[model samples]
Target: MKALVLAGGSGTRLRPITHTSAKQLVPVANKPVLFYGLESIAAAGIREVGIVVGHSAEEIQSAVGAGDAFGLDTTYIRQEAPLGLAHAVLVSRDFLQDEDFVMYLGDNFIVGGITGLVDEFRRARPDAGILLTRVADPSAFGVAELGTTGRVCRLEEKPEQPRSDLALVGVYLFSPAVHRAVRAIKPSQRGELEITHALQWLIDEGYEVRSTVIDGYWKDTGNVSDMLEVNRTVLESLEPAVRGSVDTASQIIGRVRIEEGARVTGSRIVGPAIVGAGTVITHSYVGPYTSIAAGCRLLDSEIEYSIVLSGSAIQGVRRVEASLIGRNVDVTPAPAVPAAHRLVLGDHSKVQISA
Candidate 1:
C-alpha cells in the first residue's frame, strides 16, 4: 500500500501566521508538524507516497524532496486550489493507481503512530478504514455513527447536531474501491467534494467500511492553540540531554534538552523544554513546555508554554506565555517614555488629575 499525505489546505484559522507560512510546516518541538505524519507513514511500511500540496507547494517540495529523508519514495502532486479532501484524492488518482493507500493530513498529530492501524488494514483489507476518536466537540470534525455490528453506518462532516462524538481523525485507509465511490458522489452544498461524502457513498453502496476508535492522543493542529498544545505534549516526552554550554550560574531543571551550540547562562530553565541548536538563553527564565528554536536569543525575559521559532529573539520583554512566535521576529519592550494624562477640555467640562 502507498500513502497520500494531504498538505494543501488553506489554514484560515491560523491567520497571519498562515498568511506567511503553511500551517503544516509549523514547528512542534522544533520539528515541522508535517514531518511527523511523513515519519509515521514511513514507519507504517508504506514506501511509495504522494503528497498533495497547494498554496505553499514550493516550500513543501523543498522541505520534502524525494522523501528519501523519511525513507520513502515521494511524489509531489500540485493541486491548483484546495477544493476538498475528496478532490485531493481525485487529483492524485494517477499517482495512487489501483493500489490501496493511506490518506493522512499533514497537520494532524497522532501519538503512538499508525503502525498498528496499518497492520490491521493489511490483514483485513477493508474497502475503507477510518480512524476515529472521541472528541469533546464533535461538531468541529467529521463524525461517524456506529452500527449494531460496530461498523460505520453514517458519516457527517462538521454537522450542526452530531449523532455521535466519534470524530474522524485525519488518518484514513482506503482500497482502490474508493475510486468508484469518489466518482459516484456529487459535490456538497459547499461546492467541494468532501471525503466524508465519498465515504457515505461507499456506505450507500454495498461496500464494507470499518472504523478504529483511537485511545491515544490525536490533535488536528489547525489553530495556534492546538499547535501549542501539541508542542507541549511532544516536549513532555523529551529526555534530558545537554549537548550545549550551560554556565555555572544557570540552573537547568528537569527533562530539558539543550542542543549543540546552544548556550545558557545566568538563567533558570524548567523541565520539559528544549533549547535548539545555536540558541542563547541568558538572564532569562525559560519555563516549562517552552521550545526555543535554532538561532534564537532570549535575554532578560520570562517565557513559558510557548514556541519561539528559528532566528527569533525575545529581549527585555517582561513575560510571554502560550504564544507562537514566528521566525525572525524581534520581540522587545518598547522604549520608555514619559506618561501624562491629556484630555481635550470643552466648555463646562471638568477633569480631575491626581499628582
Candidate 2:
C-alpha cells in the first residue's frame, strides 16, 4: 500500500506565521507537524508515499527531501491551486495508480498513530474506510451518517444541519474504487471537489463504506489554539534527559528533556517541557507544556503553555502563555513612553482627568 499526504492549502487561519511558512511545517514539540504524519505512514508499513503540495511547495520539498528520514520513499506532487481534498486525490492518481492507499492530512495529529487503522483496513478491504471522532461542532467537519450495522451510510461536507455528531478525522483509507468516485462527482457549490462528496458518491454507488470512531486524541493543527494543544499533548509524554549544560542555580523538574548544547542557568523549568538544542534559558521561568526550539534564547522572562520557534527570543518579556511564536522573531517589551493627558475642551462638553 502507498500513502498520499496532503501538505498544500494556504493556512489563512494561522496568518502572518503561515504568511511566511507552510502550516504543515509548523513545529509541535520542536518537530514539524508534517513529520509526524510522515513517520506514522512509515510505521504503518507504507513505504512509497506521494505528498501533494501547493502554496509552499518548495519549502515542503526542501524539508522532506527524499522522505528517507522517515524511512519512506516520497514523491512530491504539485497542485497548482488549493482545491478541495478530492481534487488532491484526483491529481495524485498517477502516483497512486492501482494501489490501495491511505490519505493523511499533513497538519493533522492523531495521537496513537494509524498502524491499527491500517491493519484493520488491510484485513477488511472495504471500498473506503474513514476515521471518525465525536466532536461538539460537527458543522466544522465532514459529518457521517451511520447505518444500523454501524457502516457509513452517507457523508456530508460541513453541513449546516448535521445528522450526527461524528466528524471525519483527517486520515482515510481507500482502494482504487475511489478513483472512479472522484471522476464521477462534480465540484461542490464552493467550486471545489470535496472528499466528503466523493465518499458520498461511493455510498450512493452501492460500494461498502466503513467508519472507525477514534477515542484517542486527534487534532487538525490549523489554528494557533490547536497548535498549542498538540504541543502540550506531545510534551506530556517526553522522557527526562539532560544533554545540555545546567548551572547549579538552575532547577529542572519532572520529564524535562534538555537537548545537547542547550544551557540553563538561574532559572526554574517545570517539565513535560523541552529545551531544544542550542537554546538558552537564563533567569526565566519555563513552565509546563512549553517547547522552546533550537537556537532560541529566553532571558528574564516567564513563558508557559507556548511554543517558541527556532531562532526566536523572549527577552525581558514579563510573561507569555498559549502563544505560537514564529521562527527568527524577537519578542521584547516595548520601550516605555512618558504618559500624557490631552482634553478636547469643546463647547458644552464635560471632561474629567485623573490627577
Candidate 3:
C-alpha cells in the first residue's frame, strides 16, 4: 500500500492567514499540522507517498521537498482546482497505479497516529475502509450510517439532516476498486466530485466497506479555534527539559521543554509549554498550553494558551491568550491617543456616546 496526502484546499475559513499561507502549514506544537500527518504515514510503514497540492502547491512542495525529512519518497500530484476528495483520487491515479493506498488529509490532526488502522487494513485487505468518529455536528462532515454487520450502509456529505453522528474523520483506506467507483459517480450539485457519493456507489455495488469508530483525539485544523485547541492538546504531552539557559531570575514550572540555544531570564513559564530552539523569553509569563516556536522573542508581555510562531516578537504587550500569532509578527503596544468616538448614525437611530 502507498500513501496519498491531500494538502491542496484553499483555506478560506482561516484567512487572511490562509490568504498568505497554506492552512496545512499552520503549526500545532511548533510543527506544521501537515508534517504530523506525514510523520504518521511514515510510521505506518508504507512509503511511496503522493501529495495532492492545489492553490498553495508551491509552499507545500518547498516544505516537503524529496520527503527525506519524513523518510519517504514523495511525488507531487497537481490538482488544477479545489475539487473534492474523489477528484484528488482521480488525478492521482497514475501515482497510485492499482495499489491500495491510504488517503490522509494534511490539515487533520489525529493524536495517536494511524499505525493501528493501517495495520488492520493491511491484514483485512478490505475493498474500502473509513475511520469515523462521533461528532456533535455531523451536518458539517461526511457522515456514515453503519449496519448491524459493521458494514457501511449509507453515506452523505454535509447533509442538513444527518442519519447519524458518525462523521468521517478525514482518513481513509481504499483498495484499487475505488477507482471504478470514483469514475461511476457524477459530480454533485457543488460542481465537484464528492467522495461520499463515490463511497455510496461502492456500497451500491456490493463492495466491502468497513469502518472504525475512533475514540482517540482527532481534529480538523481548518479554523483558528481548532488550531489552538490542537496545539494545547499536543502541548499537554510535552516532555520537560531545559536544553538551553534558564537564568536565576526565571522560574520554570511543570512539563516544559526548553530547546537548545533558548534562554529564559526573569520570566515565569508555567508548563505544559515549550520554548523552541533559539527563542528567548524574558520578563514575561509563558503560561500553560503555549508553544513559542523557534527564533522567537517574548519580552515584557504575558502569553498563555497561545501559539507564537517562529521569528515573532511579543514585546510590551500586556497579555495574549488563546491566540494564534503567525510567523515573523511583532506584537507591541500602539501609540496612546485621546479617547473619542466618531459615528455615522442612521436616520432615526438611537445613539449614545461614552465620553
Task: Identify the leading candidate in terms of TM-score.
Answer: 2
Instruction: State the local distance difference test value for candidate 2.
Output: 0.94
lDDT by residue (4-87, candidate 2, tens digit) is 999998899998899999999999999999999999999999999999999799999999999888999999999999879999
- By how many angstroms RMSD does model 1 differ from the true structure? 1.9
Taking every candidate in turn, the Cα RMSD to the unseen true structure, in Å, is 1.9, 1.4, 1.6
Better of 2 and 3 by lDDT: 2
**How high is the lDDT of residue 251 in model 1?**
96
lDDT of 1 at 90: 94
Regions of candidate 2 where Cα sits further than 4 Å from its true position:
343-355
Cα lDDT, model 1, residue 38: 93
lDDT winner among the candidates?
Answer: 2
What TM-score would each prediction reach against the true structure?
A: 0.96, 0.97, 0.96
Q: Which ten residues in a row are the worst by lDDT in model 1?
A: 335-344
Residue 104 C-alpha lDDT in model 1: 97
The pairs that clash in candidate 1 are: none
